[model samples]
Target chain A: MSELELQNKKAAAFVSTETIDGEIATLNLGPTHPATHGIFQNILQVDGERILSAEQTVGYIHRAFEKLAERRPYNQIAPITDRLNYCSSPINNMGWHMTVEKLIGAEMPKRVDYMRVIVMELARIADHLVCNSVIGVDTGALTGFTYMFQEREKIYDIYEEICGARLTTNVGRIGGFDRDFNKEFITKLRAFLKEFPKKFDEFGALLERNRIFMDRTIGAGPISAERALSYSFAGPNLRAAGVDYDVRVMKPYSSYQDFDFNIPVGNDGDTYDRFMVRQQEIRESLKIIHQALENMPQGDYHADIPSFYLPPKEEVYSSMEALIYHFKIVMGETPIPQGEVYHSVEGGNGELGYYLVSDGGRTPYRLHFRRPCFIYYQAYPEMITGSLLSDAILTMSSMNVIAGELDA
Target chain B: MSEFATKIKDSILEKYNNTSYELDTYGEHNFICSKNDIHAVVEFLKNEGFIFLTDLTGSHYPESEGAEFQVVYHIHNLAENVRFRLKVDLAQNDLHVPTLTDLFAGANWMERETFDFFGIIFEGHPNLTRILNVDDMDYHPMKKEYALEDETRTDKDDTFFGR
Candidate 1:
């Protein structure tokens, strides 16, 4: 036998021997199973259809992003952030940019801030649509998944209009956007805003009150609020457990304070509650997007930080000053302060924090991404310890543990 | 500083003696304590309503004398909306700190990730195995001494790539 096969056999023997009851079986859920949304392996000890205990083995897609960030320059690191939680790449991009901006103390213009808000909220909707609809698919309702995926495509169209990329969007810059939102982008966004709610409501109707969906998700993977807090749950997961703590409200960044919205909370921290909380959040994100668009300011979209922000391509080709500035930025010659800063944004998943430490170098001395998926995935085995095997799949979908973010 | 932060800072200073620990308000309120007293400080902070362990990770500084590895903790009090950082520095020879798993269950994987990357031993952790890396990987990849790229990859050699 191969080394891996022998090791697996030994592990299975060890697990079988450890079981107290007779006829207990061990099952490997995946590093590549369809039910496991991403590449994560869960070795579950089962007594028939019920799971006795589960041990998760992550890192199949570990990219060593933190290690890689140490070699790349500050501005070039934005593309790397895009790969983490690719479902909402813009939020990751904006969070990293805002972290660098925080380190440099660059005050962004109101127009730039509002524009960022709109983009972030649209990304939020895309993230929630995938999460909620996938939860439906895991519960054996695949129609909602297909229906909401079309709306997700519409959001992708808006993203393409903004940054010319669909999925792993390396959008925005350190100080602000690379370019302004054009008339076409605005028109598409308006069309998306007009059409998405009806589709969202219809999708909700398909799964919200359905008897089978309710029974599958209501108490299948329930966790107490206190336990959830101990696990450092954030975003919709924590909010679903009745905690009103949101990074946006707790520490508002990128003009989030100006937007009026409500923080949705749920009494029970279960699959159904998580689904409902995200559903309500989609509505709130829509409200925020509408507010951001209505109150959009008329001024410079990109911040006026010449040392950090790149000059226009047209100017770079003609003007000597602009050419020099462009060359300086592209070469990563801008001076960085020797200090540390922690900036967290209300990401699609949760509190996406960037802890950056600089030593007056071109590259970051050390950078850590506080990925929420990683934090909450730790609580999975604990939450689903006594639940059924089928329920575990439902719980995994509800957690929205993006493998990239979890492993990064 | 806000009253909430000040109260916690004062309590730590008064209890530990101000000279024993270094305190600063650089980004977040940072308290650099000895590795020996980290558990006590965490316990004190937990009792002081810093119930949320937001993040726990390690950073390596090869040049810093006597402080080779710094394990930083970002703790938050949800009710008070206050967050502060606590750091414990360890030398190369003694790279061990008390585990916070007893206080916060989430610290299990965080400590494992730290141990996996930087090789900082969290004493008293239940299962301190590598979380994000393969089990057989030998070296701590995040330490400053380690190169970011693989040396064994011959495809991207300088001669072939024309560096």
Candidate 2:
């Protein structure tokens, strides 16, 4: 058979009869598989197992968060934000509420603001811990994952102690927190802080010097700073490319300006660079969390607005006004002013923003989430272009491409 | 404020032959520009050292008369530490714009998302297929038109497990 005949025969095997040639064989990764993370499908044009091009087919996890937020009231959308990056629900909670608050010209108390910063930073640490640990596991270092999971469990325990829920924490209300942080919560946080640094150091020591781990990650998924920037990469992915662009420092939402911490950047912009960046960021998050917690202001955790923030149970039962306001806010009776605002906060992934438009009604006119995973995932093929299949998995795991965030 | 964004408003106005650019500053060098003349405007910005196309997305306003889709871009300049947003509005009928993928290689998924949600067509986008929807589905699920009948229906039908 001629070269053209063999090419035609190979093309016919694919469901979509499209073919590309560059001395590479074609491969399909997954539409359904555990390692693919979620329902993501990737069609790779390969040359001797070296991927020449990788076309990603996502939407396996699309929940249409933007469309759903349109029908729900500003406050009712908190739960929806939780679902977007389900791994870091509190950050999404804070991001969504803060965006709405900015739209409504709502100013939270200093204490409430500081508390939000602490919670958000904690969430960032938790997310990075999961990301780094998973990358280790993907690279055949299972012990690191086990060690990190122990610490993450402690963090989740603190989350449960503070909010009642572990993963899907609808913790933040519109104006402020759902409630105050008690002494027990503070004590647990302090305990976690005391032990966390040592555990982080141990985890770092376990993987940082391991030759196998270093070899697997060092040059894998190397993207130039210019390429990283153009790809709209945010969080550790962008930071790995040597840019000091952090939303918290750049914009300073939720009083992130009050705390002082350095934004770590990597020189090479590879899988190893991303790993180091995330590792350093986790340390920085701890610093921010500690500073915020120590300097936490002395004031009401919830905002003074009776209509927006839920009233205390005592006030709810005693006062008819409180009862009525509670019913009104819960039932979406409060009139939402017409306007639009784009609010972006530095999430575990990168810049997690909520672009909200209101139409003087209870429900929103529009709600669009600028998700980091969606942007970072775009660079997957470029990162894995000349690398092995295992390198692709390590690169993806290092990037921490959370399916919930990507598909949202 | 970063150098690139500080002079961006004046530069944009000058480059576009005196077209007024609404340059709203958020933090240091964060500027938001209106969608009018955005493609040409961004091309100039990219050439002048604001090379990073950090984010691109779309939001829908059902109440607005004709102008429904609003696409936003978050850009950064690595050398200058500048960040900004460039927004362009598209009507339902004229939901087309030139693809920025030529300038920013990372815009592949973001443009697909903008296409997925608001149905904004990128004229030069390579593969503008349904990214987060069923290949056979007709409507853009992110629009207000595709409202769900029940809350539970979302859990069973819209995501990976959706039929």
Candidate 3:
């Protein structure tokens, strides 16, 4: 009797429409839903299709990176930065390197600066491609996402040539890169730069002015410019809201001052504007990379810091000074100045800042990562209050909130 | 320092008229004020067009007696392209500070994160719950007291590692 009853049980039992009323249904969007693209859960108070309110519950993938950074040496912390905003990891790695560079008062060569600019811009292009294509995927255009992903893959190939790792790339060292830009890396980058614009324009044509894409994104989940500033919106999201405050342009780190590029601002801070802002930013990044490559200087790849940069591995075993320097690098025996510094770079999503406090120790006394995704995600519930359920998904993707960075 | 930055320092020094307000220029022009004057100082800075609150975080210094925690606020004046730091220190016993959510809407989450990590309570934060860690976890992990190593692991002896 038990077996027969279990076999006869229905998959889902539905309540009759007679029981339905004006009551608000609390809908859980995701701890694991396909549309979320990350581990984000929102308990939504919904009246049928329209969202009355949403209470976002983040921290599903909190790795305690700041806590971990306190224990690791300054050089070891680059890998941890890579995990934050994994979509465009080189920016985080470079930003971390630049932070320590600031702490040590190290000067990078112009060639090193230009190389960093190229890598950072490539990371930005890769990041924007993923964000824009995923926006299309959210609006039911899967073709663009699958098609442009290969182009993103090409950028990762360039990363692989540079550092022998893709995705979470620990590309550069503290003062500068571990090695110069190898020949294959340049060739791949040149090929990518040549091919990226044509294919990227096709991706834009697929979603930029498409009737279906515009309707899904134009009026969905908008924030005013004043409200965006109050919330500390940054990067493309802030630019989409009509504020032209780019850290690269404002602060001008790593020779960003040398390059001339326009910041693409939008009138409405809606999903469409965010997407379009990123699309135009990708083109600007391309322009910056072209300038950096054409004007690439001839000099040493990394700054000549005897105590900082490691000697060649072969020399480490052959020579005594090289061995001592290697130990100094691995164990971090160099005397760090006791100071506090705040260094930020325009990350893929926004201003990724690192605030470090030192007591002249091997590791940071206190370290805080100002992840942009964390700031942008808190504004989600306010953004999607009265929007349709489908529009909420588009809003999340358009905001480009990576869960790794958000919960770090 | 720029003329405006110098003006910010002078105005704050004149307004506060206290020895505790230290305008130190380490990286950015850090206006170090006591916890009592943090609210007024931040409000003053905001009025001077340093309105964008770029980042707000805390650091724990257990060895520093009387001043065990410090909340650092980084604000940027976008038009002028000037940035400044406003620091307020609190003793370990009383780790409460006035909330900046009234001034910057983004301060809500940043303050919650600071609270989650260092147990520095923002007095008027609407929902001052944990943001990055699980709820009901009693200890704040970012404090210096919490060692990152696994105390329970028998293989990695502290004596062997020269701890």
Docking quality level of the chain pair in candidate 3: acceptable
* Residues forming the 10-long window of minimal summed lDDT in candidate 2 chain A: A13-22
Candidate 3: segments with Cα more than 4 A from true spot: A1-21, B19-27, B157-163
The two-chain DockQ for each candidate, comma-separated, is 0.50, 0.42, 0.49
TM-score of every prediction relative to native: 0.94, 0.88, 0.95
Model 1: per-residue Cα lDDT at residue A134: 95
On the 0 to 100 scale, the lDDT of residue A174 in model 2 is 92
| Best-matching candidate per lDDT | 1
Q: Candidate 1 DockQ score?
A: 0.50
- Per-residue CA lDDT of model 1 for A76-183, tens digit only, reads 999999999999999999999999998988999999999999999999999999999999988888999998999999999999988999998989998899899999
* Tens digit of per-residue lDDT, candidate 2, span B15-75: 6662444533223233334444677878887887778676677766666766677677767
Model 3 chain A poorest 10 in a row by lDDT: A6-15
TM-score of 3: 0.95
In the predicted model 3, the residue pairs found to clash are none
C-alpha-based local distance difference test score of model 2: 0.78
- Scoring only the A-chain of each prediction against the true A-chain gives TM-scores of 0.94, 0.93, 0.94
Model 2 misplaced stretches (Cα beyond 4 Å): A1-24, B1-7, B14-36, B59-69, B74-85, B150-163
lDDT values, one for every candidate: 0.89, 0.78, 0.88
